[model samples]
Target: MMNNYNKEEIEKLRDLIKDIDTAMLTTSTPEGLLSRPMMTQEVEFDGDLWFFTMKDTDKYREILHDSEVNVSYAGKSYVSVSGKVEIVEDMDKKREYWNKAYEKMLDTSYDDPNLVLLKVNVRSAEYWETGSMTKNAVNLFKKMTGSDEKDPSDMNKTIKF
Candidate 1:
């Protein structure tokens, strides 16, 4: 079951993932699940995530075959976002998200016809934030005393919008 997320909850989710740079993008392929590391675009999290990709790549083709995808991030917190993807070719949007570093990395100008954007319209997300050391120690003590069965470190929530 998914819970309807409020603005505060959405903001919390965004704050949790803001610092995490890369996300593992998982897609369905003929061989099975294929996961690739994609640099997360710095954008406001309003239920959509964007990444730069080439239209001719296998990842793009796989997304076309199966639009459902998962993007995962790990750090002090772990987040799993599942969504439907669409290939965007709008030049204005490209200019908005493009950066000088990308030019050096891709060896192509923003105007390159092959350059495309992957827009992931997030459906739902699950996040887990590990507790601090002190909290974990307290939870461990509680467990040892048989006072708590759940660990404080196991902080997780699922939200749908």
Candidate 2:
């Protein structure tokens, strides 16, 4: 299925999620479902989600066992993407997205010591956004006076995974 997000709403979601920086990465665990906050370098709405993680970590194992996962980011706007995860070892892709800070934090090069990439093919996603305070107040005022207002995110565009 596709997400029924409109162009304007899509732009709003992109703007919101891009700056959120951190996303809660979720996976199924025997104990139940597990989630961890991960830093996002870039999140493009081009049908796939890309992230980096240590290849030797527990999340990697869980993903291998079951690829179903969700990533969420929220700031002024909120977004949640659900799909399947794949461990990618593409050297070129890694090199393209690599950063010095990542190596500094992980204590190893991007290509070194069991580093792996998590790429998700988004099957579905949801987004919510709030308009400017001025706009919000006007809408509220109108509603209080018995007027209908257009929602900020009801664009009618399908969200591309």
Measured over all alpha carbons after superposition, the RMSD of each candidate to the real structure, in angstroms, is: 3.5, 4.7
> What is the lDDT of every predicted structure here?
0.87, 0.76
Q: Return the lDDT, model 1, position 39.
A: 86
Question: Which residue pairs show collisions in model 1?
Answer: none
Per-residue lDDT over 1-161 for candidate 2, one digit per residue giving the tens place of the 0 to 100 score = 11554555455456757777789999998899999988776646555668888978899999999999998877776688788987889888888878998888778887775887888877667776666889768777888998856674533223444
Off by over 4 Å in 2: 1-13, 132-160
True-vs-predicted CA distance for residue 118, candidate 2, Å? 0.4
Best by lDDT: 1
TM-scores for all candidates? 0.87, 0.75
Which residue pairs clash in candidate 2?
6-157, 47-161
